[model samples]
Target: MTIRTTHVGSLPRSQEVVDFIFARERGEDYDADGFDAAMARAVAETVRKQVEAGVDIVSDGETSKISYATYVKDRYTGFGGDSPRNAPADLKLFPSFLKRIADSGGTPQYARPMCIGEVRSKGQGELEKDISNLKTAMAEHGRQRGFMNAASPGVISLFLQNDYYRTREAYLAALADAMKAEYETIVASGLDLQLDCPDLALSRHMLFSELSDAEFVKIAASHVEALNHALSGIPAEKVRIHICWGNYEGPHVCDIPMAQMFDTLMSAKARYVLFETSNPRHGHEWTVFRDRKADIPDDKILVPGVVDTTTNFVEHPELIAQRLSRFAGIVGSDRVIAGSDCGFGTFAGFGAVDPDIAYAKLKAMAEGAAMLS
Candidate 1:
């Protein structure tokens, strides 16, 4: 069997699609139905490209969602108005730099959604187009296997910024229960469910920066509980639990380590674990397999990143192979899947890697994976 390769989620969007999405977010006048049609075409093309690039597994490029987590605001209930994105501690330490970037208008910001009422999915046909478009893309692409990524309950709380729930647990439970429908539908449709869960670590600094480690872990454990409850109906084998530190180019001083969350990650009802093991900050974390080998459940799969997405330089195929080989050496090739450190364009219109380079990186990853198979 070949060593499979896939990305975290969002790939870059076409300029036309980007314009329509940005216009919608800005409350500017745009044709809503037309925008959806354009997005569908984009998704179809993206899936086709993924196949052409030799990706063993593919995604919709998250064409319909604005950002991974914040898109939940429109699809779910209780979200209203805006919440300011509190500066992460790392950025706070570089206020002058942050000010310059903001002044330059180089950064695009999404208004954080506020939780004002109660949380429940609107059953609002949000995923209808997403699911249909992906399924259609599958048939057209002659897909091997694919996973559709969605924000986990914890990540929704992390990005949307809660304002109304009496306690964090209450908010998490409501969010989890509300998100259960999305999770169930994907699995029932025979697509792998990848739960984007940066809250387990990245949010410890980005969202809950003020909390102590012990305090932060209390929240993390609660997130795990809510996630398991959300996954109650789906078989673990079909689930992919994706966690990571912030994907941006940051100092990362405040980010938590992988060793800290291994137990909680292993406890999740997921057979595949996807996370960063290529970027400089967390790259060394591949050692976690060696340090905790016996602790990992035998059935679990490790989708360690073999390519770094935050940079524009295309990784040499041999370098990519080396990264994949490391993980395979430890976990055995059968359990290793090559992946990017994180999504190429994690947020809408917020691509760091050049669009063309992103596909090159993916192609290189596929070639690298072939080395092992």
Candidate 2:
């Protein structure tokens, strides 16, 4: 069987899209029709670019979102005020590096609304628009397979703090119930639903940094339970979960090992698991899978990132092939797919990889997948 290629959702947004998103975030009035038109064009262009780069599967580049985790604020009610920013423990240990990033205007500034009341969906208008835009673009390019990214309930709880819910478990349950509609909607549209669950991994060193690894694993298990509930109605084959440490370029020394949370991650209802394997910090963890092969469900497919997303360096196709081959050797080649470490654009205005170079890397990834095939 041939190897396949895809990427972590967010692609670099054009300046026009960025302006509109920020304006709405700031509560500034903007033309509704004009925003819709802009998003349509952006989605079409992004999908076209992915096809040209030889990617087998693609996304809408998450062009309409400010950021993956925070966009839920716009879709759900009961969120207001700002959540306090929690710096990653690894980044906090190096204040000078953090200062350099901030001084250079690299840190993204966007609204992080808190949960202040009972959670409820505003409507599915925005989600429907996203689905329409992606499907239209994919049709134009003759692409049959694509996935849409949605923020996981756990990640939503991590970014948008709970002020109204009495306890963390209560907050997670509320989130799971509220987000169920969106999860089912995507699957109903005949598209793969990708649950971006950074909270499964990234939160270990950010939100629950003070807890021991065992304690954090228990918390992660609770998160998985909530996620599974949200996915109850959908087929596991129609869903995939993405796990990653923070996307920023920093000392990721504090990231929890995959071994510690592997069991919890597998507990999600998603049959496919997408996670980082290309970045230096977590690159060596492939051995974790090799050592615990018996634990992975037979139905599960592994999408290991074959390209690094944080650097401008365009990895050679041969290096990418080697990375893919390593994972293929552990699991059968049919069980693996090539992906990127995180995302080219995590936030609208904030990204480390250049737009042009990001595409170049994806092109390289496609070439690498071809080598494996």
Candidate 3:
């Protein structure tokens, strides 16, 4: 079988979408319906571009979102006001590096929303809008398979500061309950539902490294529990969970090893797992699959990233094939798919690879999968 291609969501926003997000962030009010129309157009264009890139499974490019995890604030109640967004512990460790990021204008200065009360769906018709937009694009472009991103219960916990819930675990449970219908709605469409869970691995160094191994495991386990509960009745096979450390080009010395987090990764009900591979920090960690092949259940599939997202270089098709082929050798061709290490545009208005370069990279991934097959 040919290695299949997919991507982490949040593809690069167009100049229009980028400007809208910035203006909205700056308290500039524009015509509401006009904004929606522009976003829909962007989603349509991005889907068409992905088809051209030869992606087997595509997304709506998360064009309507401000950021992947933080977009929840707009769709859910209880998140209001502002709070200090803590820099990742790793980033904080080097004050000099933080200065460099600020000086370089590499990172955007956006407000971090805080949860100020009990949780509830915003009832704003947001999720419906997203699904409708993606489905419409797929129909127009004659594509069949696609996925829409949802913030995992864990990732929501990771980025949003909680001020109302009495306990952290309670906050997570509320978030899970609030988001359960979203999972159901997406899966009900019968397209794949991608639960983006960066907290499992990224949080280890970002916020949880101060935790002992036992403490980290406890928190990680809670996250998995919330996710499984939310995914109840949704077939695990239709779900793919994506994990990655920070998408920034920062030192990842504090990243948790794949082996250390394998158990937690397995705990989610999702049957297909997508995670980083080609980026420099965790690129060499593929041996974890070779060593613990049995840890992967027979029914599960691994979409190990074969291309890097945070760089400008376009990977050779043969290189992507070699990476996918390595995973196939350890598991089997049927169990492997190819993807990027992380999203090229993890956050709106922030991207490492140029947008054109990002598509070129996916084109390489598709060509490589052909070579491997």
Candidate 4:
């Protein structure tokens, strides 16, 4: 098989591009139909770029969704007015976030349990239509394969609105049901589905911030069960689950090692697992593979990050090759596919690393795969 590469979820061409297009259309004060038409064109353009760049699996660029969590929140309905629309005080550096959102004309809304029937708004129910439209558009305008991104219920539920549910178990089960509609939508659309599940390992910080290590693990295990339950009927091979420690450019001191959560993650039903393995903070932990490969079933594929996403410096092809070789040495080359540590522009509003540099990194990734060949 030809060596393949894919992103975990959001790319640099994420909501930033959406917001940009939205601004341009609103500037003209275009009506709803005109606005959607402009947005659809923008999405197709971004997808074309990813496909042209040699990405084997292309995404809609997730231009429609804000963040993985926020997007899921928008589609469902349940909770109302639980708390003020403010960033957590502890996240001081993000103080201007709320103001920024307001400046962008975003409204503060209450979050809910994300259950079915409570709110029957079909956001992505048109997902198949969107994919079909993109396929036809791409075939006419460009050429490529496509995939859709869905949030894992475990990850979605773990990032909660305060006191939403009496018990975590109840919240998780509800999230699973609501998210199944999304999973089924993508599968039925006849496109490959990649589940964005950074919370599988990263939930410790977001969900269990107040708990002790032992307590957190106990809570996280239930989340694992919820994830497996949500994905119970999906064929593993058509699915790829992504797990990361969060995709921010920050001090990841609190990020837990996969060693601590590997068993829980592998238990989730996914034919392939996408994980962070590049970047100085995580690169050395490739040793985790040496220690844990025995537990990873042979039928499962491991798509390790060979390109670092936290910096602007382009990784040399040889370095990318070395990363691939390292993973191949342990996991078998046939089972390993190169990828990036995380999406380049996870936050649409903030511009840190230059977009041009992000493209350079993908170029390096493709070259690295070629070197391995």
TM-score for each prediction?
0.96, 0.99, 0.97, 0.84
> Which segments of candidate 3 are over 4 A away from where they belong?
none
Q: List residue ranges in candidate 1 displaced over 4 A.
A: none
lDDT by residue for model 3 over 227-283, one digit each (tens)? 999998899999999988888877887787888888888878988899888988898
Q: List the residue pairs that clash in candidate 4.
A: 79-112
lDDT of 1 by residue, 110-229 (tens): 767789989887794868788888888988889958889888999988877778999878889889889899999888877899999989988888778888887888788889999999
Models sorted by TM-score, best on top: 2, 3, 1, 4
**What lDDT tens digits, residue by residue, belong to model 4 across residues 315-363?**
9989988888887888788888778787765645443457777767787
Best candidate (score: TM-score): 2
Using lDDT, rank the candidates from best to worst.
2, 3, 1, 4
Residue 69 error, candidate 3, Å: 0.8
Give candidate 3's TM-score: 0.97
Runs with alpha carbons beyond 4 Å of true place in candidate 2: none
**Model 2 Cα shift for residue 298 (angstroms):** 0.5
How does candidate 3 score on lDDT? 0.86
